[model samples]
Structure formats: structure tokens, C-alpha cells
Target: MSQQEHQAHSLKQHWRDIFQQGLQHSQSRYHAEDFEIEMAFYGDLITHYQSQRALALAEVQKKLPQPLVKLWQRANLANYYTRSAATTQIPLLPIYRPQQKASLKHQLWWRSLRFKDEIYKDLMIRLNRHPQLHLKVLQHFLTESYLYLCNDHFMQAVHQRLQQRFAHSSEPAIVVAHSLGTVIAYNFLRANPQFAVQRLITLASPLPYQAMKKSFKQRVARPTSLLGDWYNFCADEDFFATQPLDRAPFNFQPQIINQTIHTFVDKPHEIIGYLQHPQVIRAITLE
Candidate 1:
């Protein structure tokens, strides 16, 4: 193999080893049931690492000069919104535009104040203590969010995937999207109003957050393409889904059926936990 190809292969092996080691460490920390969940989460990342890594690296290379700046913008847009006007003493804007003049220290302080919940606290601790492992996990989520929101190339790819998936099919399909997938699914259905989606099941969705709502370029409303109800299931402990999609911006015709659930797992944001919920199962399986 060429030097560049060989180097890329070696780097992939290195990350595989790191993720495996992290998985072993997680196994020791959790009980049997929870370990299964952790294993699946990390294992999927490991198994699909090559493809995901390629996609992420391609997007990063294209935006090499300003990738970090883009990440900061996406992070603020995704996490810096208030739940409601009543909850915070300070008036938080629905939209977040980074203050280019703000000092790094000021920005860090601002983020800390906004993200005071236990989930963010726990994640911050993990980020500090186990930077490699935890940062990898955070990177996976953030990369997907950043690319889809900021990169036109990535958006075109998403549209292509949707078209390819449903090109020949005329029947309305049920969509069950988890985490960042929920954001993509919502945008796709909204942008293409002819997709004929029967129902949208958003698990651990971030749609309720003003941060997510404001990030959308289009008007944030229910997808006119949806012919059935929109069932949103959020775990009580899932940091991304602290609120349900029943408020002003999200509230519209064919109202969203928001259900808050509790997934008593070590990682509440994991898709497996959300998928395994009895209510979610029924929502996906029921006619």
C-alpha cells in the first residue's frame, strides 16, 4: 500500500483499539444489564467507525480552516437556548449568534451557566477526566450535527439518501428518528412535502429546545407531509430531550403527541434505551 493509505489504515486501527479499551472500562463500571447497552453503543461506533470517520474527515477537510469555529457555532446553536421564558432569570434569545468579540473566558462562563443540569455536569466531568474516550463520544454526535447544519455538501447528501430510499415507493412510511436523526428527519420531511410519511416518531428528540428550533433555516413547523400523528418520546434523564414538543413554535395543526418516559440506564441518551421503551415500541409497531 502507499504511505498515505498505510498511515490511514494505522490510524483506524489506533482508534479501534482506543474504543475497545474504553468499552472494557465501561463494562467494569456498569452492571450486566447496563453493560449490554454500553457494549452496543460503543460496538456500533467501532463497527461503523471507518465509514463514519471517512464522512466526518471529508467534511472537516473541506472546511479545514474554520472547522473549529463552525463547531463552536453549531454547539452554541444546539445547546444555548432556554426551555421557557419563566425558567431563566436572564432573558434568553430563541436564536444564538456567537459574539465574535466575546473573549474565550466569557464564552466558557456563559456556556457553564446555561448548562447547569446534572447531565451536562456529568458529561463535563467525563470530558475532563477521560478526555479521549468521552471526547470521541461527543465528537460523534457533534460531527453529525455540525455537518448537516453547516455544510451544503452534507445537506445535498442527506437529500440524495432520502430520494434514493423512497424513490420508487409510493406508500407512506413510518419514521422513527433518534437524537440528531430526529433533526435530519424533521428537516427532510418538511423540505420535501411529497414524501408521504405516515407518522414521525422522534425518540430523545432535541426539537423542543429553542436552540434546535432556531437552527433551522426554514420556518419551524409541523411537516405538512405527515398524514398522521407525530409521537415524540423523551426519556426524563435524556439531556437532549428535557422538554416535549408541545409548546408554541412546535405546536401546530395535527398536534404532536408528546410522551415523556424514563429510561433507567447509565447513558440515557443512547438510542437502544429509547428504542427499547415499551411505549416507543408500541408507537413504532402499532397500526
Candidate 2:
């Protein structure tokens, strides 16, 4: 590889190490801390992540509009992120059992079938055989609010932290988000349009289009123009994001850039398997 590519790869590995270390530290501290201490720790993490986010954003803004950049830096937006709401636990609903058991032949056939092959076999066949399953899957896609609030808070905290780190830049900011973090990035930019977020990169986001259904349309119908130059990378086999992007419930057009990361031979989502794939590392470091 060229020197630049090697450096980029090194940077990606470094970030992965940092992320892993953060996760380890968090778990250890979480177990040792009292409720108050735990809260304090979370506060610190929020601050740190936000700062990193802001720096990254400012780097992106050099290529964007000034008015938009100003919106990203407003104090009101930061306050929105710092404010806390009451914490309440929402219980997971029980899964319904089918009254009739699968026939031995049917069960055996399904047991032998490959899940990936089945996933793309035929939408109609999958829908017909497991109608309720499909509906429930879609329902799960729509039920993001439980995590949305927390994500929103995270984005604000990141912005505050970023603002301090990248304070010198006058250009519009860029937001790079991965997985569930995409939702947080979206809300942050949407709520702070003045901040001039020039680009948004969403890696493995599960934004359900179905959330915009008649029953829930009102919640997200407002015109919020935060989604610009949005690049959405999805591993075709990353079942986690398949439905969300395809089923999102809004009229907003996202400038989605698709990436296909090859899955492991037999086991996908396993940590080692995920690690072996360069895309996971590449996504974060963008080498």
C-alpha cells in the first residue's frame, strides 16, 4: 500500500483500539460505581464523545456554507442536548407463540435452509409464510423512540464537546455516524440546522421508513433539512440495517451512498468475524 493508505489504515486501527478501550473502561467502571458515580462517568463520556464529534464536523465544514456553519454553533442547541428528561424503563413485550406447531417436514426443511438465502429468496414467499413475523419486524423498525431520546442527548453532548475542540473553524460541520449513532447525528443536525452540517455519513443505520405510518406520521413530518450529503453504507447481509433504510417513514430524500461489506462464511455478527472484515475498521477511520 502507498504511504497515505498505510497511514489511513494505521489511523483506523488506532481508533478501533480507542473504541475498544473505551468500551472496556466503561464496563469496568459501570460495575464498580455507585449510582451517583455512574451518572458522573456517563456525563464525562458524553462530553468527550461530543468533543470528538465537533472536531470531525468542523473538518467537514471547510467545504460547506457559512450561514449553515453558524447554526451548528448556537448555544441553544447545546443546551437542548444537556437538558435531561425523566428516566423510565419501557418493558419489552412478550413474543406470541404460534398455536400450531410447525410440521416435522416443514421444521426440518426450514432447519436445513440457509438464512441468508432465505432472506433474499423471494419477498413474497417470506411474507406469506411468516406474515406475522414480517409485521413484527416492521413494528420493531418503527419502535425507535425508546432509543431516539437517548441518541438525541448524545448528539447534543457531542456537538458541545466538538464546538470546543474545533472552535476555530468558520465552515459548516460534517457529521459522521455509524449504526444507531446515525439517529443521534440526524437529530443533532436537524435540530441545529444553523450549525451548517455539510455532510452526514451513516454506517449501518436502522431508520425504519415505516415509522412514518399514518399513526406515527405526525411525529416526523416536519421539514427539517439536516440530512445533506448523507452517505449510507450497508453490508447487504447486515440484516440490522436492511429494514430501517428501506422502511423509513419520511419524504426526505437522503443522498445515500451504499457500501457492500462481505459477510463471514457461516457466522455473521460475531466479533472476530466482524473484525476480519476491513470494512468495519474502514468505516470508522475512512481509509
Candidate 3:
């Protein structure tokens, strides 16, 4: 396999192993069946994004000169670093707490498994040292956001998928959107007000972020199509969900119910972590 392919494969396997180990260690909270389902979903998402990233990079390389492409990439890297530095004011909460009598090796293992705020700081330091990995991560985020927000073809495909899923059904739908999916769901519901929506649940959403809100290029408001309440769940450690949709711009007649809950320490931003939260489960299943 090519170097890029090999790297992708290794990264995928690494995450799968981490997730499996986490599940095995927390068997009381999660089941074996949950592990299989989450792994399948995670694998599909990774594959789709990797293909999209390759296509985007290839298109850019074809159109732009190599020198300009490199300059653009450097600019993006610099911008990411600046933003990360500015955001350091937000304190990172501690995730690991060991028994006083635990052995040093056991404590170290727990620290690795449950990444604390110090771990995040260490990761940022390492990313700064490794420019390639830093650029790769920045490109991944930028590529996906650009495709969904700026590329007409990509947006149309997403809209088509939503139409195929909901166009024929007359019953009210309950949308449980996570991270970037929350943005897509909101946009879809706003455009297609004909579809009846019972409840809109957004988990780990970035809607409250100024950059994300500005991308809409309009004032934010609740979707008229929504017949019921909007419930938004956020984790304290989820970087994407920096704030809840409770303040200005998001506030409306029927206020959004914003609840903060704890997720798995190893994967705070994962959908599986958000889905397994007691409050989130109750919000989705409760009548």
C-alpha cells in the first residue's frame, strides 16, 4: 500500500483498538453489542472522509502551482496555531483521579487511558513539534467544513440524502444530530419546512461558536418546522461544543433545553459517548 493509505489504515486500527480497550474496561456501562455497532459506524465515517480528503487534495494540486499550494497550507497552519493559542484561556478540566494507594505503573496506565487536561496540553506540544500531523489535522477539519459550506455539489448530495430519507414519510421525525451533523440538520430543516419534526436533539454541537454561526451569513433562530422542543446536550470537555445554545442569537420563544453531561474520558467527542449519556438517552426516548 502507498504511504498515505498505510497511515490511514494504521490510524484507523489504532482508534479501533483504543475504543475496544475502553469498552472492555467499562463493561458495566457499555455492552459488547454496542462496541460492534459503534466500530462499524466509526469505520464507515473514517472511510468516507478519507476518500473525500484525497479528492479535495488532488483537485487543489491540479489547479494550483506547487509553491502556492504550500503557501496556502502554511497559512492554514499558522491560523490554527493562532486560534489554539488564543483559546488556551479556557481551562481544561481534570479527567483522571487515582486512589492514593495505587501503584505507580497502574496510575500511569490510568493516566494514559483517561486523558487529563495535562494530556491535552502535551498533545498540543507534540503537534507543534510534528508539523505534518498538525497540518493533516487542520486540513481534515478545513476540507470537511469547506465542502459542506462552500461546495454546491457536496451540499446537494447531502440534501438529496436527507430528502430520500424523509420525503415519503408523513410522520413527524426526531432528529438526533451530533457535531457537524447538527449544522446540516438545522440547515436541512430550515430549507424543508414541509417536513414535520417532533423534536430536534443536537449533541456536541458547534452552533454556538462564532465562526460556525458566521458561516450561515444570517441571524440564527429556531426552525419553524420544529413542532416540539429542541434539546441540546454538551460535554464539558468537548472542544466543538464550547458553549450551549442558551444565549443571544440562539434564544427564541421556546428556549432550547441545554444540558451538560460527562462522557467517556478517552473519547469525549465521539457519538457513542454522547449517545450513552443518561440525560441524552432519556431526552431521546422519553415521551
Candidate 4:
């Protein structure tokens, strides 16, 4: 790697190490076995995500808007990161079983051998029978959330995962969540309204998609419950960003600050591309 590249990687690794050290220090009272496992899990998570964020950074800089690239660099210099997946705040909702079961027309929405249904059935079949074949890159959160919706047992792990991403801090956090992470952040905030947040920034968020919104209505907290500003950002061609907060469902809380950017990058959906914008940086780190 080039010297510059090596230095950048070293810096990110430094941050990861510091975070791990803090985690270790804070949890020092845990028994040796549990502490070892926690350390291993957090270590792996930071390494995996640091690599992902680095790739995203390179991609963003390659074609980021001329006006925004410098700001992006400044943000990076300050170690600001756009959260890829996250969630929040009432003492989180009690872990209890909901009375309703999966209410699809048929328990198993499949025709005997014909596979006659349209998108929903075809989608489920693919998800159930050929998930390995699909290998979608950004659908892990959806897959896990859906599993929790169907079997109550998965909720514990899902809740823990969401909680772990909260990133405890003294500074006010305006979570800049992108794509699938938007949904997770929304759910987290709604479910944990007692959890404190100063602001919420969602980019290329798919929360507006009707089917997705409907599917999770019962499972998460409503937007109205959150106690912060919700800034929704998206580009016109970002198909995943189906919903804008202003057009949110009636049940959605007061409202959100929604804006759009015209990205010069080929991949408008890239989280870093969205995050590099000056507005996005200010939203996450400044206020």
C-alpha cells in the first residue's frame, strides 16, 4: 500500500484499538470467560466495520462532488463515521411475546409445487429456500428483523445487536444512518424512547417503502415517540429511499427535516457518498 494509504489504515485501527480498550476497561469486572468472549466479539466487529468503512471512503473520494470532497476529508480527519446499521431509548421495550403470529394468508405462502404467487411468495421462497444463492449485500438487517418478527426467540439477539451499536457518549449524537440501518435506527429510537438522542439523520433510508413500513408497524416504536430532530436525506435515484418523512404515515410523529442531494458518483446509494456532504457531517457531529 502507498504510505498515505498505510497511514490512513493505521489511524482507523488506532481508533478501533482505543474503543476496544475502553470497552475492556469499562467491563473489567466481568468473569474471565465472558470478558474474553466480549472482547473477541467487539474486536471482530470493529475490524470488520473499519474495513467496510475504508472501502466506502475510497469509493466516495473517487467521484465525490468537487464541493463536498474537501469537507469529507475534514470529517474523516475528525474520525466521523456514517453509521451503516443502528437503532434506542425508552428503557427498551420489555422482551415479551406478542399475541399475533405471522398472519400471511397461508401459514406457508407457497403453492404445493407450482410456485404460483407473485412477488411476496417468490420473495419468501427465495429467502427461505435459496437465501444462500441470493447473497444480497445490504439485506442482513432486514433478514434478521424479519426472523425476529416470525420467531420470538430471535428478538433477544436482535435487541442486543441494536443496543451494542448505540455507541455510548457524552457528546450529543445525531445518528447519521444510511440505507438498511435507517430502519434499525428508527426502530431502536421508537422502542427505546427513554433512550436519549439529540438528532437523527437518515440517508437513502427505505423507511418510506409501504410494504416494509407495514411489516414492522407492530414490532417497533412509532416515530412520534422519539425526542429529537429527524433529518431525512436521499437522492432522487436512490431506489432504496422510498420514503420521505414529510410523506410519512399518519402515525409517524410530528415530522422530519428532509433534503436531497444530486450525487455525481455512479453509486448514489453509497453511504459514504451521502455522508461526505457538508450537511451530513454537521448533522452527525456538530448538532
Candidate 5:
């Protein structure tokens, strides 16, 4: 094979391995100590998804129709960071007590100094044991009965961080959310009117209220009007994303700049294409 062909082959193989490793780690046994490692693995998977998605979205723009291409350019990659709190926590994960919290706080200061030991301690002592428990706990935690608790915790953290960075911002901030993260974003915006996040790009959001809530029939619905520009995209085969966003009880309306629903029949395309669309790129570009 020519050098170019060989390089392409190598790149494909590398991505395949990276995705496989990410899947393995995410599906691996869950235990207390493994939380940090598991989170790290998940982050790696998201990073891979984000980069490959950007590349794929770029390609889709070339092949698809103008209306369809508009969808890819508007999508935003959601980045996640986890922290602990005294009052709130994920339902399944055991809350670290005051002592553990104190210990962890001290370790945070030492983290840059003794990174290796800290990682090893978390991996060996905690991570190796939690995979099974995680499966059971996450199931319950994710359910409606308990989901609000989890969302609340996540929103508090996101807001706290956002405040620290842009507490007195004049312009609206662009907020991108993925999967369960969308719920957190919604709750955060609802909690604070002063926290004006302008544009919202939601990808593969599984929140049942998302798509369906926009109708006038729903008495109770997600408050979509809070954000200025809203764009929601979902893959055809992503069952979770397919959940009916248009329901009843609470009615909702969206301030949509552009929208598209993709059905990549043959295979999943790159997510970045959503961002490449002229409108979306223009909206997000720093310059």
C-alpha cells in the first residue's frame, strides 16, 4: 500500500482500539475506588467522540443536503467534571463522610505534588471493587423517582463553577449539553435568571421532556424559553435520544435557531459535522 493508504489504515485501527478500550472501561466492573478511574475512562471516551465527531460532521456537510447540514454545525460537545458535596450526591455512590472529604481536600492540594500515589490509591483501594455495585446503583439513581436528586447535585456544581468564572458577565455564554447533562443544564438555568447562558446545543439528550415538552398541550414542561438560541439533534438509532420530547401536562416552547434529526442508516457519522454548518460555526467561533 502507498504511504497515504497505510497511514489511513493505521488511523482507523488506532481509533477502533481507543473506542474499544473506552467501552471496556465503561462497562467494566464498578466499585467504590474505581469511581475516579471510571470517570477518567469515560472522559477519554467523550474526548474521542468529540474529536471524531468534529471530523465526521465536517464530512456530512459535504454529502448531505443544506437543511440537513445545518444540523451538524449547531451541535456542541458537552464536557464533564465531577465533584462531591455534603448535601447532594449521586444516589448509588456512597457519600464520603466528613473525614473522607477532609482527607480528599488535603489530597487535592497534594495532587499536583504526588499525582502518582493519589491515582494508585484511588485505583487499588477503591476503583477495583465498585463495578457491580455501580450497575445496580446507577439504575436506581437514573430513574425518575431519584433522578431529580442527581440532577440537582450536578446543577449545583455546574452553577457554582459557572459563577466562579463568569458571575458578572455581560454577554450570554454558550452552553452545550449531552445525554444526562442536558437535564443538569436545564435545572441550572431555571435556578438563576442572572445566569444568562445564551445558546444551548443539546446532543443525544434522553430527557423525555425535551422534544415533547415544546407543545402547547403539555401542562408541565421543560422551560426551553430560558435560553436564547436552542438546537437539538438526535441520531435515528439512538433509542435514548428518541424518547418523546413532546408530551403533555406541562407545555414548553423552544427558541430554535436551527434543528435537524439524523438517521445515519449505514453507520454512525462523526458528530462534528453539526458544528461545521456555516450558521453554527459563525455562532460559536470566538472571533
Candidate 6:
């Protein structure tokens, strides 16, 4: 079907296709120019750290005596920071957090930070255990997914380009976004308050409660003529979509729907794999 079509059955198919298409395009466009250079710089930096770490570890192992060597091993080679939130009484994590269940996948990531002695424990483990592998994860997942969607300039370019596509017609749209696309789609809707969004469907979204609220604080400034329902779908194991934005901060909190999905350990947070679910399919064609 064409972009103009808004049929129930076709809409679901379009949403499914969009999720898969977005991932494919984003992967290639990731290396698009100056931004590509910046990504490359970070990748190289991780590489340099990895090489240096291996050499330094080898040297320390050869020279240090038994007990002293173990102590030195505690020192991080790459010094990569853990992205997980620290479980402290800090102002950042927020005492009034969304009631998102903890993930077993993130048990170590969460435990090392929260309800524990040191968040540094998990950070060090990641840095020390496998610098090369962690670097790859950061390159492919963190920077590629997170930064690509969050960076202001890139989003502006996308926002402008997509605005025409999103709200060009008088008919409403059911935006079914997946993974990083969720962040992009939300911001697009928020930015163009005039756009008539019939319904929003976010799958495997990373848009957390606090951050999303802060980002779209003035979403009601323009007062869109017709803004409708929002349905969010998330898998228990997918840590990215762990928290639902069903709270006060959001001008319109989404109706979050949870489910159990058997995901690949490496790519547990992906949406294309979960598109076959009936609930997810139904969400795209809502009324």
C-alpha cells in the first residue's frame, strides 16, 4: 500500500514494514558523513583502548607476584562506564520512578549499580572482562541505536524530512515505531504539535518516563487539533522498553501493554522479531 492509505489491515502491514525498513536504513545511514566520522572516532578510541588494555594486562600479569597481581587486576584497562542507572539515593534516578519490572538480563547490570555496594563493580566487570566485545556492543548498540536517535542535529534533519510524510495529509496516522524509531517518532509528533496523530504505537521503545517528560515539556504549546490514543507494547526481558510512560509528567500517558517474548540474547530489544504477535499487530490497526 502507498503512504496515503490508512486501512486497518494495510496499516498493520505498513507498521510492520516501517519497523523493518527503519532498521535497515538506519544501519547504512549510520555512516553518513561528518556524523559517521564522529562515530568512527569513538570506534577508533575504543579500539585504541582495547589494544592498550591487552598489552597493559599482559605486562602486569608477567611481572606482578601472586597476591599483588590480583590487586592490580582490579584496575580497569579501558575504563568504560556502565550505562545502567546507579541505585543510589541520588537525584537523577528519582525516588518516584515508573513501576517497570527489573529484567533478568539486566540483573548484573542493575544489581551492580542498585541495591548493592558498588555500581563500579559492574562497570569494572564490563571493562575488564572483554574490552573488545564490550566495544563492539557499544559501537553497534549504544552509539548506533542510542546516539543515532537522540542526537539533536540528526533528529532535526529527520524531523523536518519526516514531518511532510507524517502530517502531509489531512487524514490521521497511526505511527508504529520500534526501538530507536520510537524516540524519533515521538519527538517528531511533539515538535509538530499541529500534526494530527490518530494513534501512536511504540514497540521496544526506549523512551523512559523521566526523560520523555523533560523532552516534551511544552508539547501542548501548539495544541494539535486531533491527538488520539497511544498504545505501547513491550517485552519483559527487553530492558529498553522496561518502563512505560503512564504517568503525570506526560501530557498524554500511553496505555502500556506488556508481554512475554522469547528474544535472542544478543538482540533482545529488537522489534522486527516481535511483529508477529497478535497484540502488536492489533495495536497498529487500532480503530
By TM-score, the best candidate is 3
The number of clashing residue pairs in each candidate reads: 0, 19, 0, 10, 36, 0
Q: Candidate 1, residues 1-287: lDDT per residue as tens digits?
A: 01112233443343233323333333333222321110101122323333545557555444433553464355552233212212212221111224567789877865564454454635433344553433343344455554455555566666666676666566788776777668878888888897898778888776654445434768888888898989999876655566678878888977899898765323456553555455665675552
**Model 1 alpha-carbon miss at residue 1, Å:** 32
- Off-target runs (Cα >4 Å) in candidate 3 are 1-142, 214-218
The estimated TM-scores of all candidates read 0.54, 0.40, 0.59, 0.47, 0.38, 0.47
Q: Cα deviation of 197 in candidate 6 (Å)?
A: 1.2
Best by lDDT: 3
Error of 2 at 192 (Å): 0.7
lDDT of 2: 0.39
lDDT by residue (tens digit), candidate 3, 190-255 = 878788988899988867654454246345778889999899998865544567888888888799
Q: Is candidate 2 or candidate 6 better by lDDT?
A: 6
The sequence of per-residue lDDT tens digits that candidate 4 reaches over residues 164-252 is: 64544444445556655576567666676556667777887766544345236455334543556777888653433534667536235
Candidate 1 residue pairs that clash = none
RMSD values, in order shown: 15.7, 18.9, 10.3, 20.3, 23.6, 15.6
**In terms of TM-score, how similar is model 1 to the real structure?**
0.54
The residue pairs in collision within model 3 are none
What does the lDDT read for residue 109 in candidate 6?
Answer: 72
**Which 10-residue window of candidate 5 scores lowest in summed lDDT?**
76-85
Candidate lDDT (C-alpha), each: 0.55, 0.39, 0.57, 0.44, 0.37, 0.44
lDDT for 129 (candidate 4): 40
Model 4 whole-model lDDT (C-alpha atoms): 0.44
Whole-structure CA lDDT of model 1: 0.55
